[model samples]
Target: MSGAATLLLDAGNTRLKWALQQGAVRLHQGVADYADLSAWQAGLAALPAPAKAVGCNVAGPARAAALAALLAPLPIVWLQAAAEQGGLRNHYREPARLGADRWAALLGARRHHTGDTVVVMAGTAMTVDALSREGDFLGGIIVPGFRLMRAALAQGTADLGLPEGDAVDFPRSTGEAIVNGALLALTGAILQMQQRLSQRTGRTATVLLSGGDADVLAPQLQAALAVPLIAVDNLVLDGLAQLGAGDMPEQDA
Candidate 1:
């Protein structure tokens, strides 16, 4: 696996991200909406043959099958949540019940940090997972992401539609109010979890933010928490690369 490139796919709820990696170096990376299967397939087809293709899919069986169809002739190892892998433990009562995306993100965080860390993935849904200094999975919290939050409010009410505005301190308009409120909710959740992790472990926690919306939320979270926040791109793909390199054991054949 030293000089060979591996294909890594992270089939998330709203987007499908793929990367061609040679060891730790990414040669190519691309993303497409889940609805645009053709575009994703074309992107994969354009890449050179990889040594191995590995993926973690939380988009259900239909999307999984669609991905399989696109990577014809090349076998893909679709990863799943297991009891333990890549020096990280799964604390879920039913280990397999944990989302593959979240599990992979946890493993990704462990690869980069050795201390108590909180991983926040802001995508279609926001997930905040805690990992102890010794790489123990401390479970996590899940909440509706910004888009869903806004959609819920808009769809649930007649006049209040999905607002178009950035998050502000004192929102004067309806759109601004909705956006700011959602941002606060997300940031507040991360801050609360960070505080909880510190109290429970007696050590300050490092925050790792990832996913499509991370860029938008990181600054707000960092400003609100008044602490450094690290944003990593395609964390799920990083973990998948680890699995491909045999750094982590595969789960759910």
Candidate 2:
């Protein structure tokens, strides 16, 4: 699989991230909006012909269809409950109900870590998932995303408004207050999960941060958590790329 190539795409809620790889070596990567297929086409245009495509569409089937249309003559694989192979094992009662993004992130985390791990994806939505040391796909929790929390506060309350400030200590202004409040709440939730899960497992859980808010939230979360924290960007895409490479085309790109 060293020289064999594969094309991976992840059409998530916030963005569309794609990468072409030959085994562990990444050839190219690009990101676009959910509504932007022009960028998707441009990304695909860079890839060599005869590339095996594998994708997970967490934003639903609309973008997935557009992507499939673009990859018309090529064999495009959309990960489904029963269609794929070699990713995280789905132990959920209804595997299809599980978000594809979370599943892909755990696949990457499980491959990256050794023992019991907690994958915290802080993006359009905050998802905290646990995978056993032996690769059991334990469940996870989902909460309102950071920006969504602020937006909700602004929309729900008349007095609580969005402020126009950066994330500062104990925000004095409305914007700072909203942003800080949201960040604090998100970190607090991570800390709480760490405490609760660590007590039962005894082993210090490894916290992996992914998604958009990870850069901002990791520092605050690190301060609150008793365990260690690691930030991995585009983990879901990497995972998809890994899985796609299992059966990648034999020719060099």
Candidate 3:
């Protein structure tokens, strides 16, 4: 672990994120389109030979095959969702049906917080998962992300187009209205989930935000919720590191 880095990859619906970690420090990291082979190769070429390469891919099998070809000779441990992993319990009726990204992110949240935590990943699709104080995965909500929302409006409606404006309480322009509405909807969902988690757990839940839109939505969520809102980058990679450290859950038969 000290001499060689552990390569961690999180292949999401829209993008592929990677990180190389040696001990507690991250040596290198990058993001690229999941469909772009050249971009993936370029990023992989920059890293040193890893002692172990582990990944969580929710982008389907075609992308997984491409990743395998790209990382030839370096065997990868492609993680899957289990009933439990890294001290967090998966409550899905069919545990394997849970998204690998969400499972990893839940573990990531547990690694950072010992109390009730709400994991929000705002990417191509926004996911809001609640982790109890005891590290129980209480399921979550998923909705179309801001970009998707805007795109849906632009593509579905004849008069509506993608907006290029900031979020506001009352937007005068169409762009502003669309953008603000999306942001508001996202933040509103986060706040509601936080409240529900708090009520269920009897403790104020810390909101851990990640994914592409984390930075964009953090401030707004903080202003609205007035609670602890932490922005953690590459949470899935963090969970991968945990697995590399032998924190993986037992495999189901």
Predicted model with the maximum TM-score: 1
lDDT per residue for candidate 1 within 1-253, as digits (tens), equals 3677888889888778988988878889888887777877776667777877888888889988877777776777888788988888898999989998998888888777778899999999999998899888988999999889999999999999976887777999999999889999998999999999999999999899998899879879878775678889988888887887876444423
Give residue 231's error in model 2 in angstroms: 0.6
Off by over 4 Å in 1: 248-253
Local accuracy of candidate 3 as per-residue lDDT tens digits, 173-238: 999999888899999999999999999999999999999999889879979876778889888888
The alpha-carbon lDDT assigned to residue 56 of candidate 2 equals 77
Best-to-worst order by lDDT is 1, 3, 2
63-102 in candidate 2: lDDT tens per residue? Answer: 7777777777676776654223354467777877778778
Cα lDDT over the full model 3: 0.85
Runs with alpha carbons beyond 4 Å of true place in candidate 3? 1-3, 249-253
Superposing all C-alpha atoms, what RMSD in Å does each candidate have to the true structure?
A: 1.7, 3.7, 2.2
Relative to the true structure, candidate 2 reaches a TM of: 0.88
* lDDT of candidates 1 onward, in order: 0.85, 0.75, 0.85
Model 1 steric clash pairs: none
